[model samples]
Target: MPNAIQDQEIAMLRSELEMLMKEREALLRVAGYAAGFIAELDSFDVPRGAMQAAELLAECVNGLTEETLQDALSAVQAHSVA
Candidate 1:
């Protein structure tokens, strides 16, 4: 029946929406990382090696998922504090 088809379509749409939300969250996290790095670097005289390391870190982050980004950020925070 049409109601059954409508229900199925709604379910599919809900799944797609969930996927989009996850992708959005990942992008936001990446953006936040980029912003924070830019801000932190702007106020200091970063060495050439440090800048290169930051570039490498950014390259690695680009391929990571949201959960991985969270882990990486936590590691960076801990390293900075030490």
Candidate 2:
């Protein structure tokens, strides 16, 4: 009985992990689209400072680790003074 319960719990965990992986993949696809859009915008003859900022933002998105992403979000929130 105990072995059967353990097996059931393991199966549930595997399903949850698979779902999380699929969600992560979808998020990555969205991030790729956003990066592509930013690159396209950068190709336009914008001001140097603006271009640089866009590139920096793109880098942040492309190389997003959890800690860095959180930091970036916090920084943006902090500067959102309306």
Candidate 3:
């Protein structure tokens, strides 16, 4: 009986993990787009009030793991219009 309960819990956890993975992929795509946009933006044109936020976004994107950052940029490039 205990083994059956454990099996059911394990299955539930696996399902949750799959959902989280999908969500992570979606978030990565968003972050990739943000990074691309920030890269193309001119700091001088940004309002003083918004400059701090823009810098924060860039810093966060830069903090991503090297492999993850590559994946993000690849995702952006794949979807970007030429």
lDDT of 1 by residue, 1-82 (tens): 9999999999999999999987766665665566467557742587776887777766665767777666656655654577
Candidate 3 TM-score, true structure as reference: 0.80
Q: Which candidate gets the maximum TM-score versus the true structure?
A: 3
Say which prediction, candidate 1 or candidate 2, comes out ahead on lDDT: 1
lDDT of 1: 0.69
TM-score of each: 0.52, 0.56, 0.80
Residue range with the least summed lDDT across 10 consecutive positions in model 2? 73-82
Q: Model 1, stretches more than 4 Å misplaced?
A: 42-82
* Candidate 2: tens digits of C-alpha lDDT, residues 1-82: 9999999999999999999987765555555555556757835677877877777768868688876455544544444442
Ten-residue stretch with the least lDDT total in model 1:
35-44
Report the lDDT tens digits of candidate 3 across residue range 1-82. 9999999999999999999998877887888998888989999999999999999999999899999988888877776754
Deviating ranges (above 4 Å) for candidate 3: 78-82
User: Residue 24 in model 1: shift from native, Å?
Assistant: 0.4
- C-alpha lDDT of residue 13 in model 2: 100
